[model samples]
Target: MRLVLLSLLLVLAGCQAPASNQASQPKVPTFYNHWELFAIDAVKVPRLKPAQRLDVDRNYMVSGMAGCNRVFGQGKFEAGVLTFENLSTTMKICPAELDRYEQSITEVLSNDPKVTMYRGDLVLRANHRVLQYRLVKETSSQ
Candidate 1:
C-alpha cells in the first residue's frame, strides 16, 4: 500500500506542467506604419506643424514632407535599426529655418539610425540627435 501511494504521488508530480520561460522574456514592440514628426532634438518646430511626416509603405519606401518639400527614399528596417538610402527631395524654397530643419532631417536619415518605439512614440537616434514622432492612426474614408 505504501509503495503504491508513493508511485501515484510521483506520477502526479510528473504530470504537472513545468513553469514556462516564455512569460519571463520581454516582447519587442512593433513599429507603426505611419508617423508624424512631433519634435526634433527635444525642441518643437513651431511653424512646420504637421509638415514633416514619415510613411513606411509595404514596399519599404519612405516618403513624407520635409518642411515644405516632398521627400522620398528607400528605407530598410531590421533588428531595431533603420537605414534610408537613395533619398531625393523636391527643390522648393522655404524660410531659412525650415530649410535648415529639412537639411538636418535629411542628414540624419541618410545615416543609419537606431530605432526605438516607446510610450506610443517612434524615436530615431543618430549622431547624438533624436527625432521623435507620434504614431498616426489611419481612419477609414467612405
Candidate 2:
C-alpha cells in the first residue's frame, strides 16, 4: 500500500505543470507587453514611441527610426514576468540617430530579467539597473 501511494503521488506531481510551461505554449504578445527598444523597435531613438498600436505578430520585427540595428528574439512572459533566451544587437557602427536605442535597450536588458507594467509605465530591474518606461499617453491603461 505504501509503495502504491508513493507512486501515485509522484504521478500526480508529474502531471502538474508550472505556470511558465503553460504560458509558453501559445506565446503570443499582447499590446504594450514586454516593450523594449529591442522588441518591435517602438522607440524612434532620440524620441520614444508608443507600443499599444505596435504590431509584433510576426517572426522578425523591425522598428525605431530607420537603421536602429537594435532588436531581440522572441520572448514570452507569464503573468507579467519576462523570460529571455538570448538577445542579439547589431555590432555595426550606429549613427547618432540610433544611439538612443542601443543605449536604451542595453540599459534595459542589462538590468533585470523581471519587469512590472502599470498604466503606461513599465518598471524593469535586473542587477543594478532600474528602468522606468512611459507608454504612449493615449494608450494609458489607467
lDDT of 1 by residue, 66-85 (tens): 87788888877777677865
Model 1 misplacement above 4 A: 1-28, 47-50, 139-142
- For 11-44, candidate 2 gives per-residue lDDT tens digits of 8887775755797785333444334332323323
Native-vs-model 2 lDDT? 0.47
On a 0 to 1 TM-score scale, where does candidate 2 land against the true structure?
0.43
Please list the Cα RMSD from the true structure of every candidate, rounded to 1 decimal place. 5.1, 9.6
Model 2 spans > 4 angstroms off: 1-67, 95-101, 110-112, 137-142
Report the poorest 10 consecutive residues by lDDT, candidate 1. 17-26
Clashing pairs in 2: 111-126, 112-125, 112-126
lDDT of 1: 0.75
Give the lowest summed-lDDT range of ten residues in model 2: 51-60
Q: After superposition, how far is residue 96 of candidate 2 from its true place, in Å?
A: 6.6
